[model samples]
Target: MNIKGAIMRVFPEIPEFDEVDFSQYSTPYAAVLIAFFESGKSGLREFEEFVEKNGGTKADVGRFLISIFQYLLIRYRRYGDEKVEVPAFKVFLTLKGWLNENGFENDYTRLLHSFVGYLVDIAEKIAEKSDCELGLAYMKTAYLLTIEAEETFKEEYFSELKKTAQGMVAEIYRKCGINGGLPEKREKGC
Candidate 1:
């Protein structure tokens, strides 16, 4: 999506702002993001306090925070190259939340779908590294997101993505040696 470019276009004042220094703000960003996910409004105050504590000037903190969030999502899909502060699931949650809040839910449905696909792609990459369980978890989360989108937006495209996510989940399950369907029992085998 070239989010960095979009940020540059939106905030020309921060013209010299290079790549987001995620490492410098990862802790606070994760904290405020988690707060936002939980309590919604509190995150704003927390974010302000964080900026103040971090010695940020009188710039647009709100927009800066949103940029950080959007960058987080952008980086999350980059897989192993970028160090994402928030978890993968939380990144998807925040992206969806941001879209809904900014009235882009309907307009950017395809972007959301692409993010879900990226999640699945990342999961497959993780599975290739012999982490099938984690891959399955991510695929399941993608499936859940697609289902929510289908129910909320009533779009046939989300339904198709849901089916694709389900197939991905099943593929990971097979890789994990579970055959098909849910596991009947948990066995502690060496």
Candidate 2:
């Protein structure tokens, strides 16, 4: 089977994460992620309009976060013990906290668990369907995060094109936390 076929094989039967499957991302899954990540004020019609206006893909304002941060995650194991202040796990933890503060109903553990679980599930699906020896899969995981930033941090998303992904993520975490949602755990790890 091809890579896209592999992606379809692992598609989640559950609505939330299942809709995020890379292949379905062109339609149903894509729309769901857009609605979930975009503003509560946005309607399905509006989302479609945005997509139409943006030339097929949703006009994700924070599109680069996924690409650059993904690099960080893949490289984490190699750098975990090198005394780097922000390992990928830590970055993920921080992102989890941010997700929680943004009302994801999660702490770092739950957030990372959900996120990683989603990724692993997709990877398994892809492996099952595809014959490719190796693939950079998560790059396909773009629509969700950008839609998230577009809704949650419109200014930050549009203000800079070349800022560090680490800084952008940290800033998003802070703002989303301070936006009168759940207070982040004051612990250093949080």
Candidate 3:
């Protein structure tokens, strides 16, 4: 819903899309989310076509792409692997291509940090609407992304995002009956 709200802010002409019913995990909404994931695995053509069809400019599509990527990653962790094959390498390449085409290739640390923020929000949304397991999956995804971004970007913002993601993951694990949660200190061995 946050992603859809962000998209509508850019392309208001697009009508309201269907709300995803979390109870129905295999609903059309899930399929659409998987479609976005699959599209990203291949390339950004689907996103580009969406922008053109919706009368949006390249400059505006960056946030939209970022939003969908966050959602796609969430869905992938939730149900994508069971539904279809999604190679992680291809997704990484597509993300790189998105950054390059959207003019963030040279300096994308901020954008990646921004994505971590969205991931947190998405985890909260899933927590509210779906099972704690699904929410935990999103939190785990967010935490992993933060780790990767922190390694690649080395930005100060990533430290904060990583902490936020770690905190969320800890809370979710606590709720899931995993006491003590993840270690607060990042392991030197990891």
lDDT-better candidate, 1 vs 2? 1
Q: After superposition, how far is residue 94 of candidate 1 from its true place, in Å?
A: 5.0
TM-score per candidate, in order? 0.48, 0.22, 0.43
Candidate 3 similarity to native, TM-score: 0.43
Clashing pairs in 2: 6-129
Worst 10 residues of 3 by lDDT: 81-90
User: Residue by residue across 35-132, what tens digits does model 2's lDDT show?
Assistant: 33443323333533544565554224112213223444443334332221122333343344444554444343333333443333333343334333
TM-score of decoy 2: 0.22
Full ranking by TM-score = 1, 3, 2
Off by over 4 Å in 3: 1-17, 20-110, 179-190
- Which regions of candidate 2 deviate over 4 angstroms? 1-68, 77-85, 104-111, 114-190
Screening candidate 1 with a backbone cut-off below 3 angstroms (N, C-alpha, C), the clashing residue pairs are none
| RMSD after CA superposition, every candidate | 11.5, 17.9, 11.7
Task: Give the per-residue lDDT digits (tens) of candidate 3, residues 1-190.
Answer: 3334333333333232233212322222333334444434223455556555556566555554454444445554666432111222223334556777567764356555555565555555555555777767666766776776778777788778888889888878777786555533355456
- The better candidate by lDDT, 2 or 3, is 3
Cα deviation of 67, candidate 2, in Å: 4.4
